[model samples]
Target: MTEALRLPAEKIHAAELEALKADDKERRPPGWALSPRAAVTYLMGGKAANGMPISAKYVGDKRLIETAVATLATDRALLLLGVPGTAKSWVSEHLAAAVSGDSTMVIQCTAGTDENQVRYGWNYAQLLAHGPSRQALVPTPLFRAMEAGKLCRLEELTRMGSDVQDTLITVLSEKMMPIPELNESVYAVRGFNVIATANNRDKGVNELSSALKRRFNVVVLPLPDDMEQEIAIVTKRVGEMAQSLDLPAPKNVSEEVARVVAIFRELRGGATMDGKITLKTPSGTLSTAEAIAVMIGGLSQAAFFNGGKLSAEGLAPNMIGAIVKDPVQDKVVLEEYLETVLKKRPDYADYYHMLSDLT
Candidate 1:
């Protein structure tokens, strides 16, 4: 059988979950796959009781993950708020996988999403034939999750219309979905809850209602604390992504990864690493996630076009594409950054020249 292009978190990290489960001795909340402490270990990475190493899924603060897990153990839902590419969705997937043993229960909220998508819908044929009987009901991810006592994820929650988004208020507040037509309701079983993510930097997002906000325990996922931390994240993610893509490892991968991360960090912070130079921040997020994409794109470029040799020439175009979201304004930002900062560094001479030639 052909391999799947991408596996859910539970399948991708099945071994770690199994190892954690084998060693978990803590008291488990009803319907949870792993205990609260064990779930945290699976996320933050640690050695199990039998000494099996569990790889860290999220590289940020342990406290945040702990808080998220603790919230799920209660009646409140978890809302992971962060700027674009802060791993909001990534963390949500892993958390749901660890807590519920399945990450497929997800609703990708968008501007077009409606009540039918969130709460439930009807099988038209069955409804027409059977006159709104139980068999005519079409369960959505949220509805199914409630029925099975599993965690359901809502991605990009703010993208949905305020009215459609409000549909969640009742389900979240009462832990039940009412079907007035059938005079029935679906009450949440133990261990059922929601994990939602929203991009704080996005424009035109519908703000969450105060009533809806009260139903969740919001946790903000912040960007990497420093250059070293950001570089590590980019490097690790790039390596994993490259392997998945079946691309050959490029030469001096670490050096190239560091260069990409430094450029993003400088542009994002609006200053040089040494604090000696002030710079203009671009309209784009220039997030760590984009840095990972840049490196992966560079690796693919080297593997296919440059005979598996990573160079500033291979990385420059991808870097420009990531940083220059707004064609006219961001171009000026990049040019100034190249000349003022990258040009001054003797080590970045190749990057400055390549980027200048491309832009």
Candidate 2:
């Protein structure tokens, strides 16, 4: 059977969601698929009351997940604020899936995004024929979400123009979207709420106005707290991605994964793990998400080119590519790190040489 290249969070976790629903005994907000507590359990990973195993989606703070889930249960919209690769979009997708049983109601906000995409547009063909009737109205994702009382996701909310971003003010604050052309409005149903994601570190972002900011309950998803946590996250995500891509698991990848995570942590922190050697940080985020991508890329290289064996050679180029986002300054930062940090560590000799040669 053919499969989707990517599945939305709801379809991917359908069984676990069903399991949660079966075992959930707590109060459920209207239009929610699972209770808030059960939804948190789904995200944080725990066995259901029926003993069905539920996988952990987000591997960070349980309280943060709880706060995000709780925000959706109320009238206030949720804004997941974080640096890039901090899993803002990841959490948003899963939260929408867990609460609404449908994570596809999404508006991917971009610089070119306009009011029509956020609100409603006219079906021109129908409009010309029917002349401003409801049949001529083209409902956007946000419109559909309001009509259905499900969560609508706005990704990279800050990337849109300020005027386009302001269009959400009414939909969020009043839970109503007006249609001046039709002389009618779309009043949101009980569970209708918005979940927006924005990266604080991104450039050219249209900062949220104070009025728009007040409509959302901001929950910041932070980076992994430590090396072990970051490593665990990367390992888990890489394993899952490999399975999805039909790639054979590279044997003894834990060590390589650890090394990659360590390098990212050091450069990201601008210091060595032990804090003995100060280093210049790179331009890239070196985020856990990027680490997962590097691991998966390395595994693919091993699977296709190196007789199903992972090595420093396979991981080096991708690791360097991830680190050296800005060719000049980032390369300098990485070279200093390799010379000062990895060169001295005995276990990292292979990585040091491989990365040095590539750089």
Candidate 3:
């Protein structure tokens, strides 16, 4: 198969989705691609009865995925909230794909997002010629979702302006969007719902109003709680991304992956793995996503420039970039970590030397 620069979850796992649909015998809600049970299986991963391979997308708690799937199966909308790198948007996309069979119906909420983008806009040329007809009315993702009875995604929901964010309140509560120009409203069909994601870091930017909050069944997607789980997540994602980009695999990536996860976990927790030495946390969040990015970038460099052998030398630059958000404060944090934790670990002598050289 020809590789796409990026593939939607539905497209990437088309066979799995098809297998789930065929294997599903349970009652499904209207317009659903698979039954709720089958949707959860698609998210959490399992072998279909026909022995088709289903790749697991989200790696955390199965119950959490179940709750997310259940939320969408009902009239209430779903809001995935967490800190960065928790895979909120990932789960949102997969859920939309599994339930609606189309993950492209997404409305990315941003600081500058406006009502017209959320609702519907008019084609001015057609509007002038046709005079307020349906043909002149351009439908947004929300409008299309309402019309076709499918799941829609709103990413970074809290990033949108408060006034613009409230536009969803009516749609969630009443299941309809009003077009004053057309003097009519588009009511949602039975399977129509929304899945939105917001992070705690942006809580104050465009805080969800209490009225708006009540409309969604909120699910908090927490960071991976276990060390091994986080390592596995980073390792698999990095490998998959590398393969998709056709980058050669690094000779020592697994070792690097484990070390990277440990460093991030220790730094972010402000303590060593043994919990003996207390360290100062950096200004940056040092999220798992950033760790994955650093590893992927380092792997790319190693593959193309360093003859496919990843070393501490290759990883140092990206590590510094990921940790040192506020150079003045975060640099001190990294320095202290190096002196206290990394320098003491005999096995990490090369890492210590490389980081020291960079600093």
Candidate 4:
């Protein structure tokens, strides 16, 4: 296969999956790659029975992962709900990879998505030549997953229109998709399930119907519980992404990463770390993911423009962009934060001046 700009979890962790499967002595659920116990271990990271080190993909509560895995072991589908940058989609991809050994079967839901894209579409020329036959049918990722007993991912589920979102009602509840045109129905094989993600902060999201919501085992993924956790996530992801994109590895940025995470945590919490003062939160989520982006941006700026030295002045532009979503409201929020919070800290006086100059 050609080199991809990014690899799915399955591709990146194929060896770990193999090791887990090899040592999986427990009874496997119908078509799972690893047993529930081993799958959890694969996610949480540990040495398999064969002594292969499985790296941790997620950095959160172990019980939440157990609940998510246990949900897939049953008949119900899994719904990962969270605000942006909470790793809902990341966890979903890894779960599918660990459970089914294939994470490529994905349908990215969007506002423009239609029923045909979710279910199936017809090949124009082939349809004209052969009419409604299987040969001319273009099976979607969901249809193929159902036929193959694999996991199918639906990303940004709430971004799609209500009518298009409801197309899965029958598929989730009945585990079958009817094809009246071909006079045949596609029944989901055992182990076939859907994993979907939706950002809670999305505006005007098409809310899932009560009936549709009932079909899923909902798992709400919260943001990193503390600063250290968020910092670790950002550092690991930034290193991996920089390597993948062939960007220069930043030097001595751990303190910067901690500072970035601290800023986001404070803004998100709407108070200083001591909780003595309140802050007006910005329109932006200020998620850990965005912090990583800011870090990477600073690294790039340093690498090409500043003689490979990462500095607070170099990060100011990216930090400003990440924090300021609304020109008027968010700017005021950030300005107040700079004056009330950053300006008061002796250690952050340089960052305050740098950011103030840019704004």
How good is model 1 by TM-score? 0.98
Which whole-number lDDT from 0 to 100 does residue 85 have in model 3? Answer: 83
Query: What lDDT would each prediction earn against the true structure?
Result: 0.92, 0.92, 0.90, 0.90
Model 1 bad stretches (over 4 Å) = none
Model 3 spans > 4 angstroms off? 1-3
The positional error of residue 229 in candidate 3, measured at the CA in angstroms, is: 0.6
Q: Lowest-scoring 10 consecutive residues by lDDT in candidate 2?
A: 250-259
Task: Report the lDDT tens digits of candidate 2 across residue range 66-142.
Answer: 99999998888999999889999899999999999998999999999999999998989999987998999889999
Question: After superposition on all CA atoms, what RMSD does each candidate show versus the true structure?
Answer: 0.9, 0.9, 1.4, 1.4
Better of 2 and 4 by TM-score: 2
**What's the candidate order when arranged by decreasing TM-score?**
2, 1, 3, 4
lDDT of 3 by residue, 1-359 (tens): 98567889899889899998987999999989899999999998888879987888889899999999999988789999998888998899999999999999999888778998999988999999989989999999989999999998999999889899989889999999888888988989878999999999744577889999988999999888889999989988898889988888766788999998899999999999889999999877788888999998898888888888898888989999999888799989999999988998998998899998888
- TM-score-wise, the better of 1 and 3 is 1
User: How many clashes in each structure?
Assistant: 0, 0, 0, 0
Off by over 4 Å in 4: none
